[model samples]
Target: MPAPIPTKVHYHKQARELELGYADGQSYRLAIEYLRVFSPSAEVRGHGKGQETLQVGKKFVGLKDITPTGRYALKLHFDDGHDSGLFSWDYLKWLIDNREANWAEYLERLEAAGASREPLGIEIRQL
Candidate 1:
């Protein structure tokens, strides 16, 4: 069976959710943070297995832009200056279907690494 084509895509800034409607009568609402942490970029996925990087401190990340990528994927521009991930239809569907399990794994990794979902802060002083 062919993958379902997206009929509509809506980005809700207030909720930080990306809602997608598909031709197969299915829809999904994915959070921006989820998308950020599970990005398909080399920075996140890395060059091969066992090299995935843990993305932290993105609890409040927002979408800056979403651009189509040659009809097969989307280039997501994030407010935190991350714009490398290419989200394909299959990947998007997987995210939606496995959101619960994926989130659990992410949390576990964060806890194990003593990391956090809250963005870090930097203090600067005047010279």
Candidate 2:
């Protein structure tokens, strides 16, 4: 069976979300930050297993553009100057199915590494 592709794609800049709709009346709204942090690019996923790079300070990342790569994938251009990942239909579906678990794991990893999703600079201190 072939991987399901989104029938409709809409990027909500103000909401910083990408809404993907399918023919079966199912739709998913994925946050831009989530997509960026979990990008399939080599910079994020790395060259092999256990080589994946943990993405931090990407809470405010935004999508600069989204281009179709033939009929199988999407080339996402991020405002942070990252434009590598080729989000295939299969990968997108996987992401949708694993969204919750992946996000939770990412959070756990961040905590373990003492990393903040907040952009590189500026700190939040409570007195």
Candidate 3:
């Protein structure tokens, strides 16, 4: 089945949150920091599933720029010198819907592995 179309997008600079609204009368929220840290770029996501790199100390990160890639994706340039990810529309929607669950899981994994987003740079906060 085809994906639902998005009707609107809102970026709140003060809240550092992005809100997405769909034609199906659903809305999703995604934090700027979360999006930056989870960028799908190889530099951040790594070569494979287990090879992912951690991002750290990016509470203040923002979208410096965004370039649309066709009709289905966007190339984001984060303020923290990361510009490699091509965020597909579907991925963005998924992140918004699963933000809480995904973040909680990532936190658990970080604790288990003694990984710090600030230190190890994937799952912990330094600032």
Candidate 1 contains a number of clashing pairs equal to: 0
lDDT of 3 by residue, 1-127 (tens): 5456567877777787777788878888788888987888999888898898766666677676777788887787776778889888888877877888988877776677776555334542233
lDDT of 1 by residue, 1-127 (tens): 5456588988999899999998777788899999999999999999999999999999888898999887778888988889999999888888988999999999999999999998889632222
Give all candidate RMSDs, comma-separated. Answer: 4.0, 4.5, 4.5
Stretches of candidate 1 above 4 Å error?
122-127
Q: After aligning candidate 1 to the native by TM-score, how far in Å is the CA of 71 from where it should be?
A: 1.8
lDDT for predicted candidate 1 compared with the true structure? 0.89
**lDDT, residue 38, candidate 3:** 83
In TM-score terms, which candidate is top?
2
Question: How well does model 3 score by local distance difference test?
Answer: 0.76
Report the C-alpha lDDT of model 2 over 1-127, residue by residue, as the tens digit: 7778899999998888999999999999999988998999999999999999999988877787899999999998988889999999998888899999999999999999999898876744322
